[model samples]
Target: MSEDDEDFAGCRPLLFTIAYEILGSAADAEDVVQDSYLRWHAVRGKGIGHPRAYLVRTVTRQALNHLRAARRRREEYVGPWLPEPVRTAPDVSEDVVLAESVSMAMLLVLETLGPDERAVFVLREVFGYSHREVAGLVGRSEATVRQIAHRAREHVRARRKRFHHDPGTAREVVGRFLSAAGTGDVGTLMSLLAPGVVHVSDGGGLVSAARRPVAGRERVARFVAGVARRSAPGTRFDITSCNALPAVLFRVGDRIDQALVFEISGGLVHGMYAVGNPHKLGAAVTPRLLSRKGHETWKP
Candidate 1:
């Protein structure tokens, strides 16, 4: 392979990873990565000192630009908007980081921030970029980057508490949620949710869903029950780990219709994010477990 090919091979994964972290859409991230590769090849012979950093910076800037435009598009969106789904490898470390960084609940909270604030927070907190590095990537002063990150942290904390549950606890809670929803057991579902739980659904105008967040346990419970009643017969609910956090995916005749990703605070369910947009559903790539279960035709 040529030097350009070698660089693309080495940098593509990292670039995609950074883009996904910023944009929260795998499709968009892939596009950003492809675009970055084009730029890389265009300047192949250029002397770049830190190739990894250069790629990361490029991808981040591209994602940031996309996000700025996306925000405007969302202003006229028909319904709720959710982040795209992300499939994960069944690994411990990756899952843990993903649960916190890419969870639907977290992504929704991130939408409240400006593009620059979101970029700064992800680069500094999720990717562990140094303040100086983040400053360079965002073209801001180091102190400004720190300030943006600090403010973003506070904003997230005020909206939802950190999820500190062990993996086992998360699995257990998600299992109960799946069982409750599948059985249409409103009582059980209510029992598991925190007193002031919130449910946010993003149908992106392609499907019918609440236009705004439904807050409070009773409202959320009623909505879940209504969905259960309307579910097509023989629909199956599976407890899967999305982004390394416990989540539930609903399958209708082998096609994934919706995914529920959540936030757990102090062992209680604080928030539930329902992503039903067909566009967003494309992120539900076939899991390895499905292939081993003798299932075919499952695609994201």
Candidate 2:
């Protein structure tokens, strides 16, 4: 490999993560990173001081552009739209801030922000970039970037609920939910669910799922139990992490039918995002490596 290739390769994980956080889709993030690499290759000998920073700026711009275009597509999307779930290494959970940044709930909150605000927030809050650095990355004035950051922070903090369950609490709740769901135990399912529990399934118009969110503990419990009881023969469930949180993958043989990630607060399930879209499920076949620092293998 050429020196230029190696240099950009070294920054791929960070670049992919930045794009993923902004767009909430691994497929789109990979495309943006590849396009950035092509652009980076075009100006190899231009004496760029820091290839990492240069690639980051390029990827950020590309992702922002892609996001603006995607808004129209999402408008016409069928059923409830949820972010594509990506698998992460277990160590990612050790960093509470990093884990929350990629959580399904947080990603949904970020979806409400404008493109520029999302870019600024991800760069500044998630990646630890300063106002000046973020301004340079997003091509905004430092003062303007600060305002955008403040506004984004307030918006996020207002909508985001604190997830206070420890790993053991999460595991126990998930285990019980799975058992009750599999056995069609509606009463037990309701017991484990919060009073206002909500279940959202993203079918992407290609599969069968609820077109809107299912709310209330009883309704969600019945829905979950009904789905489980109707599962195809030989169906199985795999416990794993989706976006660095406990998740269950429903599978038939080797093919995954859906990926459900839970939101546990106070030892009760408050929310669940089930991604039944086949396209979104492919990215989680292998866990992607992520880091707050810019050094790790680019692809996993």
Candidate 3:
């Protein structure tokens, strides 16, 4: 490989992670990384002293631009919009902070932040970038970055309170919940859900799903059972890790029909995010490796 290629290749995982956390879409993250690489290729020979820092700055800017441009589309989206699920390796769960940062609930919270705030918060909070570094990456003054970071941190801290369950207990609960839902066992489902459980489905108006969140254990259980009863024949469910947590992937024939990721706490399911949009299923077919400390070895 050329010297330029080697430098960018070495930082691809970290770059992709930064972009994904900022953009909340693996596909878009990959695109941003690729775009960054092309830009790097064009400028690498111009006495670049720090390849990783430069690449990260490029990716952060690209992702911020993308997020700003996507706001209108997301605002107009039909039904509830959920972040695209990314299948993650088991080792990712070993890092509690890393795992929680990528969870659907966390991503949804991030969606509430403005583009610049999200970019600053992710670099400062999730990736441990210094305030000066974050300011450089996002093209803001140090004081501005700090203020945005503080505000963004406060917002995330206030809203990010799901999916802190014990892994073993969470897996067991998810397994049983899936079985009960698949079999239309409302009684068992009710026993497994929290009294205030909330279920949100995002089909993007391209598939069948609840346009609004279904709340309460009884309502969620019945909704889950009803959906199961309406599922087409030959549908298969595979329990796997998504965003470093246990999740269900529903397949129809050879296509992924939906993904169900739970927010488990107190040994019971408290929040459920069902993503049925086909556009967001790319990660389900091919898991992406993630790293917070430049340790990821997965290519593509």
Candidate 4:
């Protein structure tokens, strides 16, 4: 590998993680990283004191710029806009804070923040960057960054609740949910869902899905089961990790038709996010990209 490539190898994942958190899109994150790489090449041999810092700051600025422009497109989104789900390994980030920051729930909360606040909060909180570093990265004064961080932290804290994850219980619930739907037992399915459980699907208008979120256990259960019944004859569902949590991947032949992620709280499924957008499924389904586990022993 070239010197620049080797230098960036270690920090590449971190850059993507930062960009993804800021922009909430894997595809866009990759673009930011790529753009940063080109900029790195252009500045080669410039006696850059810190390449990692330079690259991260460059990527953060790119993501912030991209997000500012993309907000309009999101405003015109055809349906309830959802973050593009990406595969994450348990060890994707050595820091627990960074690892957990990408959860769908957190992403949803991040969506509500302004682009600058999101950038400040992500750099300061998620990645553990200091107020000064965050300010330099986002091109704001330390005081301004602190203000944004405070506001962002307070906003997310108001919305984000700590839900302890129990993998065993989560896997069991998800597995049983699939089995219940497969058997067309709506009652059993409803029993596994919380009363306020919501089913949100994102097809990006490239495919068919519930444009608005489907709420209520009974309603979500029915919607899930109905979609199950509509699956192709040779389809398959396998338990896997989406955004570092238990999720289901629907495979029709070799290509993935949909990626479903569930949020388990209080021993019941509280939220369901189904990504049916074909454009976004490539990263969500690549076996090499994500970690997977089977739930053959799941009982309803």
Backbone clash count for every predicted candidate, in the order shown: 0, 0, 0, 0
Enumerate residue pairs that collide in model 2. none
Per-residue lDDT tens digits for candidate 4, residues 49-95, read 77777887899999999999989899988787888888765454344
Model 2 lDDT, residue 115, Cα: 95
Say which prediction, candidate 3 or candidate 4, comes out ahead on lDDT: 3
**lDDT tens readout by residue for model 3, 1-300:** 986577567677788888998888888998999999899888877987777777888899999999998888899999999988998877888878789889988898999999999999889988888999888999999999989999999999899876577878998999888889878999999999999899999999999989999999999999999999999999998888888878889999999999988888888899899999999999878677887765233221
lDDT of candidate 4 vs native? 0.82
- lDDT per residue for candidate 2 within 1-300, as digits (tens), equals 997688677788888889998998989999999999999999878987677778888999999999999989999999999999998777889988889999999999999999999999999899999999999999999999999999999998899866766777898899999999888999999999999899999999999999999999999999999989888899888788889888888888899999999999888999999999999998777788876666443321
Which regions of candidate 2 deviate over 4 angstroms? 296-300
The TM-score of candidate 2 is 0.95
Query: What is the lDDT of every predicted structure here?
Result: 0.74, 0.89, 0.87, 0.82
Candidate 4: regions farther than 4 A off:
92-95, 287-300
| Residue-level lDDT for 216 in candidate 1 | 82
Clashing pairs in 3: none
Superposed by TM-score, candidate 4 places the C-alpha of residue 280 at a distance from the truth, in angstroms, of 1.5
Worst lDDT window (10 residues) for model 1? 290-299
